[model samples]
Target chain A: MTHAVSNGLLASDLVKNFGSVSVLKNINFSMNADEAVGIVGPNGAGKTTLLSALAGAFQLDQGSILLNNQDVTEKCASARCNLGVVRTHQIPKPFDGMTVFENVLVAASYGVDADKQTAYQHTLNAIQLSGMEHVANRQAESLGLLDRKRLELARALATQPKILLLDEIAGGLTEAESVQLVDTIKELRRQGIGIIWIEHIVHVLLQVAERLICMDSGEIIADGEPQAVLSNPQVVKAYLGGGIE
Target chain B: MSQWTNSVTIQRWTPSSRYAIVFAGLVLVLLALAPLFASNGLLDRLTALFIYVILAAMWNALAGYGGLISVGQQAFFGLGAYFTIRIADLGLDPFISVALAALIVGVISYPISLVMLRLKGGEFAIGMWVVASILHLMVNLDGLIQGETGISLVSLNHYDSAQRLTIIYLLTLGSMAGLLALLFFVLRSKTGSAIQAIRDNEEAATSVGVKPEKTKQLLFVIAAFGIGVAGALWLTSATTFLPKTYFSVQWSAYMIFMVLVGGIGKFEGAILGAIIFFLVETWFSSTGVWYLVSLGAIAIAFSLFLPKGIWGELERRFNWHFLPVGYQVVEKNKINTDKK
Candidate 1:
């Protein structure tokens, strides 16, 4: 399938630290518009931290993050959101007391410049897209795991972001639910929303991401086509069992 | 064929049980008519209860809807009383002065919210307490407010005792009902949904495009205005303004207790809590330390076992709410004129 003209995101020498522990070290990467990239890493490899820096949830200890061509490294999360960059938490943090519909309504109204009627329509569409119509009025806290993950995606989609950062959204879903989620991601890609999925479900990532990068101790060890990156000697050593060739 | 019809039907299908509305209406009617059957002392107590309802409602709006649990709302209450008293000293009618005082308090609260909004969670609660203390100290030091001796509302002397008391009681009831109606309208609006979202999850709300600071500031100002009006009305009913009475932390504590026991996020909960609170206070007035002990015990019980409060628990169990906040979609039937 042909992709949209690539207005690639660029990060040069990204560095981040949590107190004395460095979580990301001189990380460099770029992805064109409509590109679907996946990052796989061991537990402490800073996959989530990198997503946070790119989403502007945290100030980078060092490095520049450019969306398209503009520097967004110093912007706050909301500011970056307005620039069409949005992220979902790995834990699926839907507003606990708010209903499923209300959650998306807020994103549609405030995330973009849509007016009330337009925002409402957009929110309804997002709900339909996320397949949350059955429980639209239910309190978010009352939802089970699968719905919570769907709510997380609905919220991100409502923002109408150009680039989406998804963090472990499939971590706890059943295999069938993960397949359904992967289909949803594929559907989003069909609409031309660039996606960066961080997942422990490596096979699902392989199904969706055209390119994959494996991280070990905060730095990318391999970046290439999915199969090639997964089978790279360094990736096999870092992720695959020690006995594997 | 039109989308609005579909939306209306969707809303109708999710109707909360009608019993909640009937109960809320029953309470409003009772409060409105209470003055006719009660003795003067009881009437005075009822008036105090009305003020408490408004104060508790404001606190619920701030903490329940806005997710801002303020322990310092009494500062606005005291400021409202002091400002009303000051304005009445210049010969304005006390009722008009109340409105003016609320406006002033609202304006002042915007800047105050700017500083306070910077703090989140525990820090925000502590900041409000500090603000309350500073205001309490300022009131105590001001010679014009009688420097802690307090000031008697000068205009109360102009009218006969009965006339003054009746007018004050009616004004308090009117203000309470009016504020309740206003809040009801606001919570039904699009902005109210945003506020609820913020309360649910600040980050999630922000991601969806809800500007947390703006929504919070707006609600904070409205709460401050409403509480200020309640404070002014309290002063008018009592015919005096005492710093200790107006700015006391106990007022905040009482408001919190009322909301917690009535229901934190439900509108009817505030009124229910206020009524129960007044009755408890009246019955236990002579009990002294036991009264304080009982109050604490009841509050703890509600928080621990009935976190939804009386109305909230009732609503959850029975699926009831007077003013609903979710959307409903309507279905349309098309007509054919084949015979014609």
Candidate 2:
């Protein structure tokens, strides 16, 4: 999270107001290369909003974002993705009519701007890494929940991102399915790609994230070591449903 | 004793349908040579068929792959006719005017698409139709276009009917085949992949670096250009350009009917649909307004009963493919050399 730089992402003074209600309140965030950071927040807490703004899916009322120490605050989502800042939607958004391979291949070629040979290699690597190789030729929409999420991750990874922002990828997954996803996320970390994962599952997040960020009402309430952030009284109060209930 | 081990060569690629082998160069050669001996009436009919095929194919690419449900494409189709007639009236070669009109209409589509594509789904569809009507009225104001009186392409009169019909028919045929090939290659290219990605999921496509606006705009102009040429061909056939008829929403209705019934998203569907539509129209168009009602009825029936359209339904049921651009896996174990 340090500003010293080395292929990391930084967002400063991020602010977004949706019709007078501030969804993101002057947030400053940073993540380093190969780092896995997790964000946990309650409903209406604006966690997804933060990811969207950073991803350029939404423009900030006020903010500047940088990828790999270069300013990309004004770039569209696709341009930001080409610059190695790629994100996955909270919901799986695989291209319905396209096969699973086509989805990843598209991301590999377009998002990361990989050349043809490289795109093919990257696509295969991504499908293999995300464990979607088995259903590579299947139409994306035909897949079930677990496979859809895998396709989503495979799609994102195929883009060859220097930094990846994940939003609610573990939502609606069974505990066992979430573990499989957590393992995939860990494998992504081993590939040296920086990750900013937003998840509702605290235990899964705790297992993978070295750093944890807690947000409530559009503001970061706690940021630090995962264990410490989870135990912080403000963090616990804001999220974690006030413990046992 | 020696024996063949029968070692199978396993590959990772998808299997292409063998049906394309049936559509080999022989068919193209036959089509190219048909007009030489065919009667003028048949040539006239074939020219109309070519134009509709172009319309159906372009509409399929726009609505099917790009998810741009524009029912107002006739605006450009009519514009192509008017522009051709206008250019031809200026004493330019009537045949060359088609290409010029296509380019001009394509450039015009850029600004228009920016405005038109801002609306999505039904609103976009309706917006385009309204735009077409406005264009139709605007074109009517031009005295050179002859307003409601219409204008014959008298420049083509010098060539005589037989020679003129053959040239235009061949050109129309050539243009249709060229554009269809272009559309096919585009869908197989990376841009096509990105375009389909936008169709399937715009937000997701954007997140993964597919430029929705750029891809869509490009497809819009390309489709406009193709449709404009088809319009020009229609003008050549009729030898006159009627703004009211050219700008009629019936063109879009016909395109939607063909694409929907044949296979809205399938490339082969456009061709097959156009062929079926051409035959049906020939048979019943003489029945007056009842023909229009039947077309409408057929389009509705296909949309309701066969949601995937004919080719889509068949592909799901029978795994039939004529233009299989996307990959289709066949397991290695299923590879039987005896069948080959």
- Per-prediction DockQ, in order? 0.36, 0.49
TM-score of chain B of 1: 0.89
Give per-residue CA lDDT, model 1, range A107-218, as digits (tens). Answer: 8877788887787777777777787777877888999999999999998888898899999999999999998889888889998999898988888887889988889999
Candidate 1's DockQ is 0.36
- Put down candidate 2 lDDT per residue, B180-222, tens digits, no spaces: 9899888878999898899999999999989888899999999
Best by DockQ: 2
Query: For candidate 2, what's the RMSD?
Result: 4.0
- Candidate 1 lDDT, B1-340, residue by residue in tens: 1243244223421323345466667877886776677688877887888898899889988888878998899999999999998888888987788889999999999999999999998788878988988998998887888777899887777888877777888888888888988887788777888898888777766665567898889999999999999888888887689898888888888988999999988877887898889889889969999998888899999999999899998777766655665553223242211110
Docking class of 1: acceptable
Indicate which candidate wins on lDDT: 2
lDDT of 2 at A180: 86
Give the residue spans of candidate 2 off by over 4 A. Answer: A1-6, B1-24, B329-340
